[model samples]
Structure formats: C-alpha cells, structure tokens
Target: MSDKVFNKKIFAYIVAVVLSVFCFLPCLCLVEAEEQPSEAPTVYAADVSVTQGSGTYIYVYAKNFADVSGLDLFVRYDTSAFTLGRATKGSFISSALCDVNAETAGEIRLSYVSVDGVSGDGLILTVLLYSESEAEIKDYKVDIIVGDCYDSGLNSVAVSASGCKITVKEKQQITETVTFYSRYEDVTKRKGDEVALSFYTYNSHGFASADFEINFDDEMLALKSVSLGESLKNTDSATFSVNDKTDGYVKISYAALSAAPSYVTVLEISFTVIGDKDGQTQIEFISSALYNSDLTAYNGSKSIVTVNTEEIPSVIVYPKISLKAHSVTYSEVELDIFAEKDTLLAAGDFFVEFNAEEYECVDIVKIFDGSMIVGNTAFKAGMARLSFIYEDGISGDTAIARLRFKVLAPCETKSEFSISGSKITDKDFNEQIVEYVGTTIVVPHDFSNEFTTDEQPTCDTSGSKSHHCSRCAAVKDVTEIDALGHEYIHHEAKAPTCVEIGWKAYDTCSRCNYTTYEEIKAKGHTKAVAVEENRIEATCLEKGQYDSVVYCSVCNEELSREKKIIEALGHDYIHHKAKAPTCVEIGWEAYDTCSRCDYTTYKEISEKGHTKAAAVEENKIEATCLEDGHYDSVIYCSVCNEELSREEKTIEALGHEYGEWIVDLEPTVSAEGREYRKCLRCEHREERSVEKLKNDDEELSGCFGTLDLTSIVMIVAIMLICGVFVKVKSRKSNR
Candidate 1:
C-alpha cells in the first residue's frame, strides 16, 4: 500500500499493454490482406480437336499470372472419353522445377516451384490426350482446377482455373495412289558398256521418305555407281544412303524434312555388262515403300527394267566432259570439271567462258598436282584457258580441277558458262576424242527463311543456327544465339568435422555447371577410441577386411578410418585363353582380374608387321622422244591394302634420231621454200627455210628494165597504196 509499490505496479501494467498491442497488429494486418479484393490469376484451358485413335495437345494458358513461387494444379477428364499421354511444362515456368503425376485414372496433378518467384502471362502447361482406338467420335469436357498456390513471401494466392471442350473426329482416309516406276529406254549394250537407269516416284503426295531394294543378275551385270537425285538432297534434314555390299542387290534409302512433289526422280544407277556372252538381264524392284510427311505408308507398285547385251562391231566411245557450278556460300561459287571414268588423258587444253559482269574468278586448284603448273592458265577478259599435262598418263573418274569464283552480283543472278576448244591427247600426242558439255552458273538464293538450330545455346556458351537451301541442303545465313547468363543461388558452407573436410560458402548456378568453392581443412580428433565393423571371412580365392574406426570421446565423432586386413586364402590358378595379335592391334597373354580385387599381370604381344605384296608399277609414264618417263613401283600390305613402300625411278627419254633432210620443195626466185627431216622413233620433225635462189644476179640486174621517170613514179605510188590497203584491211578484221 506504499507509494513505491504503486509505481512498480503501474510500470508492469504498461509493459504488458505494449506487448498485447504489438501482437494484435500482425493479426489485424493479416486479416485485412485476406479480405482485400484482388484480381485472381486466371488459368484457361484452350479448346482443341483430336483425330480418333490419334493424339492431340490441350494447351493451358495463364492470363493474370503474377509474382508466384509455387503452384499446384489438377486436371480431370472422363476415363471413358480419353487417356492422358503426358503433361509438359510451358515456357512461362520453364526455369522452375516442375513435377507431373498421373497416377489416378481420371486426374493429373502438376506442381511447380522456384526459389526466385516467376512472373509472366503466357502458356503455362500442355496436356496431351490420346483417344482410344475404339472410342466414339464425340465431344468431351475437361476441367482444369487450381490447388495450393503461394507467393515469394509464402502468402496464399488466389488462382482461378477454367474448363475446356475437346472434340474428337474420325481419321481422314487418303485416296491418292503413289506409283514407283523405272525409266530407261531399252537399249542394246555390249560387254563392258555402261547401262544407265533411273527410278522415279509418281503421285507421291508430298512424301518425306522412300526406300527401295533392287535385284539384278549378278553374273550378267556389275554395279558401277549409284547417285541420289535432287529430290533426296533438297531439304534441311535430308539424308541418303545406299547398301550394295551383297552381290545382285542394292538397297537405297532417302529421307528429307521437306515434302517432295508428286513426281520426283529418286535415284540413278549405272551398271556394266559383265556376262561372258550376249544375254538379257532384268533389274527388278524387289520391294518399294514411300512414306508421307506424317509417316504413313503410301500404296505403291514395284517396277522393272530390262537391258539387252549383244556383240557388234567395236566402236570407240569418247569420254564425255562436263562442267558444274554451284553456289557454296552467299558470295562464293565452286566450279568443278569432271570427265567420265574411262577417260585416259595425258594432256588437255580447254577454256571456260563466263559473264565477267556477274562473276569474277578468284582461284583455280588442280586436284592432281601439289602445286599449280607454271604458265598453265591463260586468263582473258571473260575466258580462262586451262591446260594440263601429266608426264604419267592419268585416268579420270573424278573432278580434275576445282575453281572458286566470287559472286559479283546478287545470288539470284544467273550467268551462262561455255566449255569449248578442248584438245585432249594421249601420251603419244595422238589426238583423242572428247565431248564437252556446257553448263550455266546460277547462284540461287533458295535458302529457307526459317532457321534450324544446329546447336542450342547454353547458359555460358553461344550456339549457332542456319538457314538451309531448299534445293541443295546447303547451309547459309548462319546466326549465333546469345548465351543465357547463369542464374546463381547462395549455398551455405558446412562446418569442418572430426573426420570430414568442409568447404566455404559458395554460389552455384541452377542451369549450368558453374560454381565457386574453397575447401576447408578437416579438424583432427582430440580424443579417441577404437572399434571394428563389417568383418568378412577370407574365401578360397579372395581376401577380406573389416572397417577399423576411431571416435572422439568428447563429441562421439569419427576421428580416423581404415581397413584391418585378413590374410587371403591362396588362389586356385585359372588359365585364360590367349589371343593372337593382328597387323595393327596388339595382343595380350592370358590374364585375369582377381575375384576379390582388381589385380592382373600380363605380357603384351607386339603387333604383327604388315604382309607386303610384291612391288608393282604405278603412275607409269611411257618414255617419249622428247620427254623423260617416270614411275613409282610400290609395295602394298596384302592384308590392309595400304602402300608399304614406294621406289620412284626415272626412265631417260630416247633422243630423236632424225634422217637426212629431203628436198620437198625446190627454192624459187619469188619466195623461200621449206624442207624437213623426221625422227625415226616418233613423229618428230625439224624444218629449215631455204634461201631464195640468190635472186639470180642476171635476173635481178634487169628486173626493172628501161623505165621512164613517169613510169617509175607510178610504180612507187602503186606499191605505197598497196601497203596502206593491206594494213587497213588487217585492222578491220581484228575489230
């Protein structure tokens, strides 16, 4: 009842009141937040259509999605209507960790979370539904309902989800007919002659892939070459392959991303007649399949072609030479010169003419020589003359020269190229026949506008993508995608333990292998005790051990760890099979890893040396009267067919032996007459001019006899006029 006691009571009362008010304020604020009107995030399911027995995607979009760290959603569908294939996360929450569960028959639950809250308004999820193969074609309803949702602060968030309708329709039937046929004119071919045939597809209905297997009489025909046509190599993802390892059969497969036309030439094949006698062989299509863009097989018919062989008067068929030019880049074109396989050429001269206004020659590389031959090329305004000579006669089935050009104009511009003046000769300088085919150079801008990604960009590295040509699958317009910088989160460090080392606090990227860490030394044990665990008994072929551990008496933490060994029971030796060494691979003696541990010892056998075949002549050049001959006699490995050694030897030329000069034309007073002597070994000739019979002094002295001054002046004037007329005529002809 004293004054001091009253004061103490008043202070205690005031402290209690302050505590009560502080606690009530939080409750009041939370209640207000829960009651406050807010626009709830909307989850909308988009209406979709599906084909009966096929699958379709039902997109779930978000409209008012805002700052959220976690979400849970459930989608319910009628079990009898359709089944769920899968639920995939959309780009809206791609950076977050997501989980989908469809354990229940009629419901699917999708849950997602992120440490850093996600905020966006776009597609949220995709649900795939597949109708039963026997399900009736009708409309079905789907309800997308929201479950638990939370914000970054762990506060409850309101989310509203809507329902969608799915309409299932009957699959459409294809009525178009696809046909496969061979195109070849039945021609009479002799043994060793080449027969060409092509296979085509009609009414393909925009097919994506084709496979064909062809059979022929192996004894009568030999497969020479197979080439894919434009339709097979014209897409960004095109692939073509051929398997002809087995005799009498060849299988060709072609695929492209882009759809092909109704009629397309698929492939061309060449064969050599090899039958001993005159006979006929049928190239039959054993099996054919054409797949449309949707991977549905199209009904097709097989085809066959016949080739007849006969003996006739031998006729020499000249090799056909061709020139091809194609754009390699947006600003570069590659020109290649090719000849048929049977062209045995020693020297040749040819010219390639093009429009100088549209393209400019940049470089020319001959494939046969290591270095360009001096003075071998003569470049004029619009033409380039290419001449080459191989001391050793060369046979060709490949490109002889590759020329690079800079496109001076737009890629769409076209320029014509003409090949002419080709004089090919044998080593003996005999004129050999060759047929030249002309071609045009068109730099096409057929690259597709849509780019295909070649490499996807990672968190720290850039990626590349390109637009590919629609007709040749050539890559162009390459672009680099920027790297997505890493998203990092802090990770706390663990304290060093008595038996384990620790690391300092660091940050780690969520998307990539990027981290920063520093190790901390382990704290050694202060107090100790010893114990044993996991004891194992030794076996007939194995050793065993038990874990020996030490513990700190203060914290009961493990201080030291080791294994106490038990002696092994002697092994019962087992023999292993030995393998012989091959020409390239080394062999090993019998060895084995012990049954209890990885322990083995063996001797390595040296690789067997190459089995060399006898040396044979290669790249031989016949000796000529004027040029030296050269050849390389090489030994090859019989097992691997690799060249083992080469001995290059030169053969001296046989010098020309000329006979005595013969007077073919006697000297005349008006002009000089020539005579020649020819070499005895080859058609080598030497000629010298004979001086005009010394304008016989008697005839020359009186050549201009008894002429008046007027006549002499007239004669001089006539000679001047004639000289002038000749010069003028020459100039006109040149122009």
Candidate 2:
C-alpha cells in the first residue's frame, strides 16, 4: 500500500480505461455504416464502319448516370444492310425531346428527353450510317434496345444494351470502257463539198488518256481541219491537244506515253459544205474522256453523226405582191408575175426595172388565164419591157403578167421587180432551170395631203388649218378664218370729281386691245370751303376730331374732309369735388377743367397715415425663487397708441435659489433614526437622528439559535473532497 500509493492507484485505473474506449468507438462505426446502391443507367451502342457508298457515325453511350431524364432506344439495323441517315443529339441532352423513327426499315425508333435533368456521362445519340449502294459487303449488326429509361427522380433508369458493327466495304470498280463512233453512218455532201468526219473509239481498258468534245452544224458545216487519226498517227508517244477550232465546238486531247489502243481513231473532222439551203450536219459527241492506264475513270459511249446536202436546181420566180400598209407613203404600186417552175413553160421573155425618181411605168397586162401572150411593150427611163408568149404549155401555177406603176412624189421607193432578159422554154424545148425570184416593191410614202399651216389668219381672232397623214394618222385640212374688223383708237377723257363719275369719249381696239366704258353723270358735291384746318381739341375726356381741307367746287382738287364733330362742346367740365383722406391724412384730388380748350384731368392724392403698430407691454417683474423676469418693450400707433405704454418698469427678485447637494437617502444600520435633508432651491426638508450600530453578537444573534452540526459536517466533507480532486486531474490529462 505504499509503493507510491500503489502506482497512483494503478494510474487511475488506466485513466478510466482509456477514456471509455474513446467515446464508444465512434458510436460503433456510425451504427454499422452502409449506403451504396446507385449506379444504374447504362445505354451504349457504338460500332459502325461504312463504305459501299460510305457514311458513318454511331454513338449512344450514357454510362453510369443519375438524373438522366428519359431515353428510349430500340435500334436494330441491317435493313438490307444499313442506311439510316441523321439522328444526332448528343452532348448529354442539352435540350432534348427527340424522337426518331426510321419507319421500320429494319427498326430504328429512338426517343430522348431532358426537361432539365441530365447528369453525368455524356453522349446519348448520334446514329447516321449509310452503306448501301447495293449493299452486301459484310458485317452489319447494330442492335440496341432499351425501351424506357428515366431519372431525375422519376426513378426507373436501369438499362444496359450494347451492339454495333457495321463493316461493309467493297465499293470501287470502274473497269473502263468507252465508245463513240462515226465512220460515216450516212453522209452525202454536195453543196461545195469537203466532208471527212472520222471520230471512233473503243477502249476496254487500255487508255493512257483521251478527251474529246465535238459538235457540228455551224450553219451546215465549216470547221475544215483537225487531224490526228490514224489511231493517233502511229502513236508517236501519242500527245495531241487542239482547242481553238470553234464555230460550234471542237476540242480534242490525247495523251499516251504507251498504252492507248483498244481500237482507236480519235478524230479526223474536216468539214465544208457551206450551206445553201439543203441542210443536215449533226455529228455530236459533246465531251468524252476515257483515261485508265492508272489514271482511273473510263465509262463512255456517244455517237451521232448525220451529214446530207444535195439539192440545187433553181427555178424561182416571185412577185405576187400585196400591201395595205407598209408604213404608207406611196402614190401607186402594182406588180404581179409568178412562175416558180420546175419544168413546163413553153416560151418566155422578161424585163422590169424601176425608180425613175420613184416610178412611172403604167399598165402592162396579160393574165386572163388565156395562157400568156403579151408581146412588145417597152418603156425607157424607169425601165419596163415585156414580151411574153406561153403558148398553152404552162403547168401547175400561173399568173404571168400584170404591171402598173405611177408614183411621183412624197416618195420612199423600192420598186425594182427585176428580171432582165430571162428565158424559160422547157417541155423539151430545153433551156429551163430558170431561177429568178426577184422582187422589191415597197411603196411606202403617201402622207395624205400634208399641208400644215396650222393657224395664221389673225386680224381679230379666228384661225385653224391643218393636214396630217404621215401614214394613216389621217386628219386633213381643218379650217376656220373669219373675224378681222375693229381698229379704231382714241383714249383720254376723265373729268368728274366732287364724288366722281365721268367718261363720255373712249374707244380703243387697235386689234383687240379692246377698251370702251362711257358714262358721265355725277357732279353733286360742290359746297366745301375750308382750305386747311385740323382742330382736334375737346379735352377732359376725349371727343375731338375735325380735320378738313376742301376745294373742289368744280374740280379745283384738294379734298380731305371729316367734319360733324361740332356737337362735342361736351367737355365743359369744371368739376372739383373730392377730398377723402383720413387716419392722419393728406389728400385731395378730383379735377376736370376744359371749359373750352386748355384740357386738364387729374387724380392722385393719397397718403392716409397710421397703419399697424400696437405693442406696449410695460415692465413686469414677478418671478422670485431666484430671478428671471422681464416685460417692457413699447410701440404705439395702431391708429393712435391707446393707453398704457411704458418702456421700463419691472425690477423685483428676492427668494430661495440654492443648488449643489444631491443625495436624498442613504443611511442604514438598524434604522435608529432614518436621516433626510433637502433644499437645492426650495425643495427643503430636514429630519435628523443618528446613533445606533453596536452589535457584539448579541447572544449569538438569537432567533432560537442552536444546532452547529459539527461545524456543518466540516464544511460538507470539505466540498466532497474538492470535487473528487478536480475530476481526478481531468482524467490524468486525458490519458
């Protein structure tokens, strides 16, 4: 028991067993920890490879999510081998609410949603795969099916699908094979012929290069040169190019450092046939290129060639004219002669020329269907000589003669039905092929009576004359002229003043300057005689105006009169009655003095004294307990300063006024004589009584005093041993 108190009581029982197992093992591991259930949203997909006709992109993903707010998959694919272009919407649903449906071409029904809730793990849809140019290259799986999955607290989101593998590749096969031909399919040139046209090709795969573009019919052939054909002329390493041969296209190019002949003959072209009415020249192969010696791209076939051209036997005769209006300006024109014969005319002779300053060959008939017969008929200057004889052998169409012309002015001519010395005697009389379709008879220049002198017959008004018909604008000679009388002049006569009215001789019309207004009769105001006088003086209150300056008894002129104010003798006012000013006053004014003319009016006299001021408080002094009182400050004349008005009088003060001493009650010890004192300026009170504080434990402070219980049990066992020695020194410094 004495080995230092047995090791301080065995270290206080090992410091209370290590503070009671450190507060009970963290409350028993938080009551057996447990909480880990979440990790449920899956949705994957991703696979694609595409090539047959290429295009690919496949995503889906959405891994361990949380607030995913909706997604409904169902993919499938292989719709005969993929082809579903466009689904897109990934970034984890930034505003989703999608819904795609490939309409059953192998199933593709997707649905997505996110009305604000899409937590974690990205990408939810991308799709778009294509591969089907005839598809069938391989692999192709793509199968993902979920149905409905959600989160944002609407729970139920536990889906896990995955499938994708497109693959499909095989797409690239051109194999080359071009062809375009024309070795004369149907050509037949004649009109100044020159034709050549070759253009042939057939390449299965041997082409190093080839490019051509040919098009014809530039107005029936013209492009005359473009060689290089003997299968590219021995292939001298074959390199040819030609571009500038344009009338309607021709561009060729050939390149072959080696292989180039699967049957070739590129181009020969060479055209001429310069059109003359017989047409046909189509040869087209506009743009063709076959290159495949490693420069891949060969697929062709184009050939169209046509050439024709041969007619030329002329026998045209024309002049079957008709004209109602060709911008009319003609005086006369008539022509008729028709004979476009391919053969069958027995006899003929022709002559027609015109424009002798615009025509003059009048009449030359012979057309009764009587089979032509109008012999010698000659004219000189404007030329016209006809001698026809058809002796009844005229086949088909006929109307062989009729000519009449006569227009000599307002001319705009073009008459030259020319046919000089022509002869046609077919029917085996041999000498036909007569071509003469000549005719130029334009007669337009008649302007019907173009007289124009619009209006010029002026002497007193009435003129109009016109004529306009440049070509049917028809309007001829509109005339009207009559009125030329009145040229009398005389002006100057004005005499009548007194109140005016006079004019008896005035006439002026030097050709419509028209003037005449005669009247003479007002002379009745002639009794004025006050040469100059303006007296406007009537005083005291206005009523004056007399201005006069008369002098026109018979026109002596000088008038300005304003009389009739004579009754204004009304201001004889001599008023003088007014005097009102009181209250300590000084007033007087009310005047009017214009007995006849001095004119005077006045009013202004006011000064009625004494206004405001009545304050008279005499000296008053009454506040005593210690001085502070005053009154006296006089001011008189509210109208006269009534009675008491002192300026000095209050002076009194004599009573208690003391301060400093503020403790009212503070005294104790057995209350022998409670003290009191007061008077800090009239709050005076005083009561005195002291002496009674001496208790020497009077009988041990009696009150039936008795028990000491062993000194209160020694101060309650010394405060319970000092609170157990300060909680055992705070658990030995917390162990």
Candidate 3:
C-alpha cells in the first residue's frame, strides 16, 4: 500500500497469475497427448549386413560375443576391385581377416558400416569409405561379423554381407597393339614405301596363316584390320598401327583395333572388299562359335558363316542309302541304309562311300549264302558273326547285301559279373564257406558297389551289408540281396590276410561290387575234410562228397579226399602186417595201452618181449588163424580155436585121474573182470561107479591149500603188465 498500494497488489497478483496460466493450457494439451504417442517404426537393429567367408582359410564367426562391442567395418575399393586392408583400431573392424582386397585394379569393392543394426540397445558402428569422389579416401579391412546377443534378444538379427565377385585376386597384365587396317595385296613389288598391305588369317581351328602388313588410321582413312588371331595359353594376339594423320575413330579405329589387344575371345571380323558391282561395304564376322583355341570372351552365340562370293553350293540334299535284306533269316536283323554319296548328302559319313554288292561267297556262312565280311555276317562261336559295319562304302544298294548284327550274351552281369554254377568249384565248398560267416557276394547284375572293409568269406552275404553292417544299407534301395543273412559277423582279422570273413556286399559307393569272399585258402585244393572224411566216394556226385580236391601225400595237404586208389592196401603186404606207427609207412594201427600198469595188454607192440601171433584181420576164429590182441567183446572158439586158458589142463593132459582131488584154487570174486577159482575135482556122490578103471593112472589127490595161487597169479600178471605211465610229447616240431 505504500509504493502505490504495493503496485496495486502487484498488479493484482499479476492478473491472478494470468488467469491461472490460461486456464491450464487446454488441460496441458490433453495430458500431452496421453503421454508420448506416434512416430516409432524404423527400429530394425538386430544386425543389418555382414557376410564374409571365403576360401584359403579366412574365417570370422560371430553370433554372441557381446555383439562385438564397437564393431566397425570399412573396406574400400574402386581403384578397380579391392585394395586397402588390415584393421583392428588400425581403424576399421577387426579380430579376423586375411588376404583380402589385396589392392587396386578396376576395383569397386566397398563395405562401410558407419552403423549397422542390432537393437535391444547394443550396437556401435563408425566405419566409412568413399570411392571415386567425396575425398577419395577408400578405407578397407574390416571383417566384422557379429550378432546373437541371445540372437540380439529374439527380435531377430542375422547380419550377413560378405558376398564378393570379380574374385581373380591375381591376374593383371596389359599389352596393346591389335591393328591391321585391312590391306594385303602388298603382293609386294613396291617402288618406294607407303603402299604396304599384307593381311592374314583363315582360322576356324586351322591355326596360323600369317601375312599381316597394313597401316593408316586417317591419312586417307584405313582401319579395318585386327587379326593377331592365334597362339595361346590364357591367350594373346596382335596387329596394330595408328596415326595415319588422324581423324578416324573408325569406330575408334575399330575400337583401337580390338582395343588393348590381349583380352582374346570375341574376335570380330568385318569385311567389305568388293570391286565389281559397286563395292557396297558389308562384311561382318565377329567370331564366337566359342571361337576355337578355348574361350576367354566370346560370351555365347556369334558365329556368322556367311561368305557368298555369290551364293555358291548351299544346296545340300544327299539321301538314298540302303542295305536291305530281301528277306533276312540269319537272325540279328535291322540295317537298312542306302546312300548315293551325295545325292543330297545327310546320310552321315561326312565323306562317303558304302558297299555290299553280293559280297564274296558265304564266308564262315551262317546262312549268308553270299558273304564277304565287309560289315556283318553271322554264325558265331562256331565262328564268324563279326558284324560292325558303319560303312560309308556303297555296300549293296540292292544286289542283296543285308548287313546287320547285334548280340552278346554271357550274363553273370555286372559287379564285375558273376553267376558261377558248377557248385562254384568247391575248394572244400569254398573252404567250408569261409569258416561260417554272414558272408556276401551276389552282386551279379545290380552291380557297382565299392566300400571295402574287406571280407569275402566264401560269400553268402545273406542279403548283404554282407554282415559288417553296423549301418550301411542304401545299396540303391536294396531289395534282393536277401536269401536271409547279414546281421551278425562281428568279423575280425583285418589286414594282409588270415581271416576276416564279412563278405560285406551292400556297398553302393562308386559301385561295381559283387562282394562275397572267404578264404581259408590253404588251397592245395582246400581239403580239411572231417565229416567222416566226407565219405560217399566214387567221385561222389550226389553232392555227397568229392567236390574234387586231392593232394596230401601226408601233409603236402589238400585232400577233401579225391579218389585215386585204383587198388589200394598193399604197402609191403597189407601195410606191413598191420603194425603201424614206425611213423610213416602207411600202416598205422599200433595198440596196447599198458606200457606197464594200466594193464591193457592185448599186446603186439613189436619190441618183441612175448611174441605169438601179431597177425590180424583174418581171425574168424579158426583152428589155425590168429590176431591175438582182441577186445570188441570176446568169443573165441570156432571149432578147436581154443583160447580158454588157465594154464592148460584138459583132464590133466587126458591122463585121467578120478577121485576127491582138490588142487587148491580159491580166490574168487567174479563180475567178469577178474575171476578165477580152480577147486580141482570133487563131485561124483553115489552115482554108479562100477570101477572099470581099477588102476587108471592112480593119482587121486587130497586138498592142500597154502598158496600156489594160480602160480602166484600168473607171475603177478607179468609184473603188472610191464608198468609205465608217461606223457612227453615234444614231438620235434612235427618231425
């Protein structure tokens, strides 16, 4: 109230604070448009570009090594196609790089990453490189491959941009001259300079035809020669000369006579040499039938063979080629061709002539009443059917020549062919089928198979993986190798050979496989025989035995037993009286097991201690026959063929003595193994004894018993049957 009423109450509180800030400024602009709306998209930052991976060991992987922090990229080129390398704070991107953009040549390689993508807030780029302008500072060397911070957090990011082209990081050579302003009638003979014209070239594979000698680009206009046409290895050619006093971009003097020469392939030839009806200049030949000497440029389609020194001989027709067989009977038929050599000419044989007329009389004849083997004649095996005639020779247009042939059958078909029938030359049945294995080897037609873990044991590959199939079955859908095997064969013994029978044949790899091999192969003919020596011998052909193999004259070994004995058994009279084992005389029988105490002495062990009758095989138990060491169940008496002995006493040598006689022998314990008791005589009790023998050698004895125990038991059974129990067996290495 003092400074003018306090300035009117401070202007009335500043007009009530400007009417309360313009009444809340439209409710604060509707709450700031409901708090920050619109303007969003463009947030694709999970990698935008990066793809570099090429050859000779250049690798750089990145998916989540923290999105490569400040990951940069620079790469520059336009000096031609790539140069400037090395990075890592040397300023571009780094951590991986090599032999890259080696440096300038027609380059245009440019890879700048001033800021690639990858959001979720993780991306820092600052790479730059400008080419051909904007300060011409092409930067390079930055192989920055980075992504996957958990794959940039699922927002999806796969940055890749390494594609490269024009990759010949090595070649660059430049040579110019390609001139020859069309002129060659220099048929020389000149009088003093300036009229030189030589010219050359007639190529279409005919290589060199040199002549060249024509100049002048503008003195009087002359620029139509560019043919250095041939001599190559990567390629090169020549012919040039400009400055005829200028003014002839004769198409830039014919593109500087095929500009800068050396880039071969794409040679163009233009012509206009006419001197007779107003030479209207119209000759163009630009080479591209893939221009001979092997490619470098003629990028497809451009051969124009048109040189009509006035449309001469383009009237081709040739046709009328025949070799008909009025009625062919000799089988293999089909050869009908007739050519008049040029009657219109498309009957093939580029340069023709074909014949058969009546061909020389029945050569090796197979019904070919008249035959000169000029092309085809049949009969085969019984000789002559060698017909392979592609004759351009006018052979029999009608006089009857009918030449044609095609037939070749001998099928086992393919995995190198196999169908072996005759029980497969049984080497003991293929060594008993390579010692029992899940064999294989039936590729006789569905051929081509090569995956060798090697195992061909007498082959039976039960439908093949041929057993070693841990998992190898794609033999082209493998349908029929299955007769039943192949799921086992752990098969061992791998290299050099001893035994590895897998027979493994299911190999589609590089094909041509019949696989089925098992080889015990001691092969004298493979005889290990032992099924009772595979009997049924008589060259056994009922498959009973004898698949042919014989060769063991005692281990020269090879005898599944093949017959050869016209009449055997008499090596010195029946294997030397049947006493064998002197080791080799083909006798072999030698018996007697008790050398001393095993008491099996039915002996003839010929060291002769007690010799009697070692003879055998004929004792049908006769009165005079003998084979003394017998035991297959005793039965000796065939009429007086006596062997019942307890020390001979037929009624005491028949001297007859009757009475109560007891020659003491009581040690009986019989069960048929050992029983003996001779209680002598004592029996006739009261049965009419009218004594008609009053003094019959009077010798009736009484009973005295005190050991005469059968002569002390036959001398202790011959001293315990000559005791001995040994088993040495060193055998001197099969002596």
What's the lDDT for all of these models? Answer: 0.76, 0.65, 0.28
Off by over 4 Å in 1: 1-38, 173-735
Residue ranges of candidate 2 with Cα displaced over 4 Å: 1-69, 72-95, 98-147, 150-156, 159-502, 505-507, 510-553, 556-573, 582-586, 589-592, 595-605, 609-735
lDDT of 2: 0.65
Q: Whose TM-score is higher: candidate 1's or candidate 3's?
A: 1
Q: Is candidate 1 or candidate 2 better by TM-score?
A: 1
Expressed as tens digits, the lDDT of each residue in 1-735 for candidate 1 is 654675466556555655655556567667767888767788998788876655666888877767788999988987896987556677788788988788988998889998898776877777767777667788899999999999989999888889899888875554555777888878788888888989877666887877777677766889999887776677658997899865566788878887887687877889988875666778876333567778876654568898888865567767877787644665788877776756666678778888888778777788766323322233887777777676655555756777777777666566787776556776677777788887876677768789999999888788999998755557888899988678888889977877688899999898877899889877766766688878997876667789989878645777788888887786555556788898888998888655644456767899987998989999999888989999999999998788989998899998999999987788997688899999998968899998888656767667675554445545655565566556656755776
Instruction: After superposing candidate 3 on the true structure, give the runs of residues whose Cα lies further than 4 Å from its correct spot.
Output: 1-318, 322-735
Q: Distance (Å) between predicted and true CA of 194, model 2?
A: 76
> What TM-score does candidate 3 reach?
0.12
RMSD of each: 56.2, 43.9, 53.1
Q: Each prediction's TM-score against the native? A: 0.23, 0.21, 0.12
Tens digits of per-residue lDDT, candidate 2, 327-371, equal: 223665666666644446667677776667766767777864656
**Model 3 scores what on Cα lDDT?**
0.28
At residue 385, what lDDT does model 2 achieve? 74
